[model samples]
Target chain A: DVKVTQSSRYLVKRTGEKVFLECVQDMDHENMFWYRQDPGLGLRLIYFSYDVKMKEKGDIPEGYSVSREKKERFSLILESASTNQTSMYLCAREVGANYGYTFGSGTRLTVV
Target chain B: DQQVKQNSPSLSVQEGRISILNCDYTNSMFDYFLWYKKYPAEGPTFLISISSIKDKNEDGRFTVFLNKSAKHLSLHIVPSQPGDSAVYFCAATDQTGANNLFFGTGTRLTVIP
Candidate 1:
């Protein structure tokens, strides 16, 4: 079974503060992704990394960035946290060969 | 613009019955469609998937049917149980190899036993 670990299950940050959400996958998947889930909006992609040191912007990449310095770890950075940024953040790793993706438990963030 | 749409916000069904969840997409480039189930406070987990070439794919009690011309797909769960209650999301991916997925708003399913 594949395991994806998220650093925090819940987080609270003040507005204008920077936030970092970390994720790690046991399986050496080539693709990693970050998404934010909001009510009635579903899950929107923030950023994705295909390989170490490689990154790509998804549909809603504004105010968010990602890092992949290691093959097993992916990090999402919120440049300046705001109330609108508070949402359930999910990290997923894509297994090759049509196996689909494995996702972490997710981190529920609240910005005050 | 929402590329994928799951119009129904919620669905209620009785145990031992079938639960059908529908999804639609507007992107013609998408060739792969997937269904994911997510429990409260948990991340979404992959449930079933169907490629564009195949119209139907079944695994145990779960089945996914795809209609290419209509750009629509549906997931059917037979003999629904209380454990099947959760939010179901419809997702699609294009052929670009970017691994980015477009997802719908999801449908919250409640199974009454």
Candidate 2:
């Protein structure tokens, strides 16, 4: 089984503070993604990395950025946290074609 | 504009009955569809999937039916159990592209005992 681990299960940060959400995978999957889940909005991709040091912006990449320094780790950075940025953040690693993705347990972030 | 839509926000069904969650997509280019189940505080888990070439795919008590003409798909859970209660999301992607999935808002299914 593929294990995708999110460093934090829950986090609370003050507005204007910077936040970092870390995700690490046990496998060698090259594709990793960060998404934020909101009520009635579904999962919106924030950023994705296809390979080490390669990153692409997803649909909603306004206030977020990503870093993929190594093959197994992907990190999402919130430049300046806000109340609206509070959401359940998810990390996923693609297994391969047709196999779909394996997701981490998730991190619930709250910005006050 | 949302490319994929889940019209039903929530559904409640009695245990041992069938629960159907629906999804629709506007993009005709999408060639692959997938269903995921998410529990509270947990990331969504891949449940089942179907290729555009096939109309139906089944796994255990879960079956996904796709209608290419209508650009719609549905997931049916038979003999629904309490464990089946979760948020179901439908996603679509064009394999020819970057493989970025377009996701629906999701439907919350509640299985009553």
RMSD of 2: 1.0
TM-score of 2: 0.97
Local lDDT at A64 for model 1: 96
Query: Per-residue lDDT for B1-113 in model 1, tens only?
Result: 99999999999999999999999999998899889999989999999899899999999999999999999999999989999999999998874676557789999999999
TM-score of each prediction: 0.95, 0.97
lDDT of 2 by residue, B28-80 (tens): 99989999999999999999999999999999999999999999999999989
DockQ of 1: 0.68
> Deviation in angstroms for B18 in model 2?
0.7
Task: State the lDDT of candidate 1 residue by residue for A21-56, as single tens digits.
Answer: 999999877789999999899998899999999999
TM-score attained by model 1: 0.95
Query: In model 1, what lDDT does residue B18 have?
Result: 98
What lDDT tens digits, residue by residue, belong to model 2 across residues A1-112?
A: 8999999999999999999999999988788999999999999988899999999999899999899999999999999999999999999998755757889999999999
